[model samples]
Target: MLAKHSKNKKISDKAFITSGKAKLAISKYGKENVINATLGVLYNDLEEIYTFDIVDQEYRKLSSQDLYGYASSITGDENFKTSVKKIVLGENIESNFPNIYTDVISTPGGTGAIYNTFKNYIEYGDKVLLPNFMWSSYKLISGEAGGGYDCYSLFDSKNNFNLLSFEKKVLELSEIQKNLVIVINDPCQNPTGYTLTEDEWEKIMDILKRACKKTNIVLLNDIAYRDFDNKALEFKNIFKDIPENLLIIIAFSISKSFCSYGLRVGAQLALSSSHRVIEQFREASAYTCRGIWSNVSRAGMQMLSNIILNKNKYLELKIELDKSIKLLKRRSDIFINESKDIGLKILPYKSGFFITIPFKKGIDSKVSLELEKKNIFALVMEEGIRIAICSIPSHKFKGLASKIKEVLIEIE
Candidate 1:
């Protein structure tokens, strides 16, 4: 039966089916017994141990009526709709996010939101542009949607987003394809943890604008970890004057931001020049959501709405989350700085949980396996290892770095 199902499906032959680093690390260390710094998971103050007194009571007081029911029913609830609108507009502008939207669809997770957004817009065989080094899911999801996806190489030794390479890809794609979608993740990028410089972002936006002027392009900005970095900036204002012909979709999630991984709550904001176009896209998106997960959890949506609605609660949560972010940053600094001090080459890490360390010539897999012997496991990406700095205690980072150094020396 499984063989028949596989034969019927049109799976992509070009797909890379290797297991991820997180799994390898877990396997080597044993799932229940690993000092895993391989996944970008927050590991502090996660419990609701401290009560907010009245706020706790208020949260408990909320009934089903108070929460937005379905995606289509969101606008009917005046208060819920208003809060969401405020979040999308610049009214309650936070550090990283600026533009807010009037209509937003709640989804099960960031991946769900991405799936729905792509399903709404992309047709079979349509091509989407993505950076080569992106979350592995982008290609998988695009292929599942029956869309042809292409990569704009970011193979620079500096590990930065190359504007010239991006432009060349965009121009080449425009010559061949009529419709394209470009995806970008900022702040703490996955795998490499590299962030774009302000100048690089400006050039990228310019390239996007120029490409959109010539051909139809959709900009899908996945701000999953937008709040991870203290130095992160808002670019919504910069995109305000973008061509009306272009469609911008923002995928937001609280999993990484609030450490609410199990909740699986996320929202998708679709921006377009035409209200009619937005409405049509939303209908398609809603259908896709219903087909996939039926509906998002009421409890998760209520928790997020409650926190955002109460200013004091929001501030308190922000402080707690900031503490965790700072801890992760400190750990990342120690690992990266120590590697540099010891004359070890590391991929440029600007603002993410991961730092990629390339192995000395011919020493990638051998070093990784040897570290496994020492109870140290990391995600090996291509010829490098992706260190999950956010997963380790700040005090443990130096010791871990030293272990990795020792392994590298042995392999060399």
Candidate 2:
């Protein structure tokens, strides 16, 4: 007999299936003739998948042992864990976190970080709060952990972070569960490209601090697309002081940042003022790692560690990443400007891979099907059509926004 969770388990995600259709079209009509934007990966103007030269070259140069061997520890190699702390919290640790203790555990990627978080933090049959708009995997991860998930509205009428909604959900869930966990996918949130302002983040922290009096609060900051953010390390200062009952776990990823998606390297960073809390976190996260991936990739960890430890390589990587950011900005600008001209609405966007076109609750699937007939392939969700601007060339963005608008109106 199959386990209860295993019986009805199916891969219900549409992203890959849609991408497969796009791929067949690309083969039949050529990539130049097809507008394929179903996946989250980045592609250059030449229609080639992008892989950072700095990361690629460094990885290729790794010693055979590093490339073939396991990471030295279940958590990670020491250097990687240290560099990860620096990357997640920034170099000014003493100034930012004068009194807090922090811990890092390497995972297979940001996905693994979240998996561990959901597995460890959420109790069975308990519900975890997620944003209304997010990467689909959050729900799957929660389900895998035997926890239910609910979504809070991501934006208000003014199209700002819906803190009112967030607070209501936080309080409502705290009343129901002894331990509360909320996942905030931000800083270039997938499918929306939205980043929370420092003020919004401050308000969120304040809300959590107040909620902590009633129950333990765990805020999982999924920062997978953080390097594409508008500011560098500006959000780190918000962690200066924290309530003892509030646990902030940041999910760090190298997939999008280093163009090392296949390498599967990332870490979870736990920040708390209580030293004992950190020790407990270390044990739990490391134990979860052994059960799941055992250890992360030594070569990928070394690649990032090498880049972070050396100022020259770090600067070099930054320059290249800045170029990609600029390219993404230009692409979004083209689409955003054209969208405005055509009267199409997108959710608030600052930086990152995608732009979401909000539609009526049930029409997103219809709109997406129509778009497919026009040779445009995008990921369709319950609420909107997701345009992967990162995978499309800058020039291709022209007029496509208007075309989407036309399609929307025609269907209506």
Who wins the lDDT comparison?
A: 2
- Candidate 1 wrongly placed segments (more than 4 Å): 2-34, 45-89, 92-102, 359-367, 406-412
lDDT of 1 by residue, 252-298 (tens): 77677756676677777777656665787678776777677877766
Writing each residue's lDDT as its tens digit, candidate 2 over 217-274 gives 9999999999987584465558767888788899999999998899999999898888
Model 2 residue 387 CA deviation in Å = 0.5
Report the Cα lDDT for residue 356, model 2: 96
TM-score computed on alpha carbons, candidate 1: 0.82
Which window of ten consecutive residues has the lowest lDDT sum in model 1?
12-21
RMSD of each: 5.0, 1.1
**Model 1 Cα displacement at 168 (Å)?**
1.3
Backbone clashes, each candidate: 4, 0
Q: What residue runs in model 2 are displaced by over 4 Å at the alpha carbon?
A: none
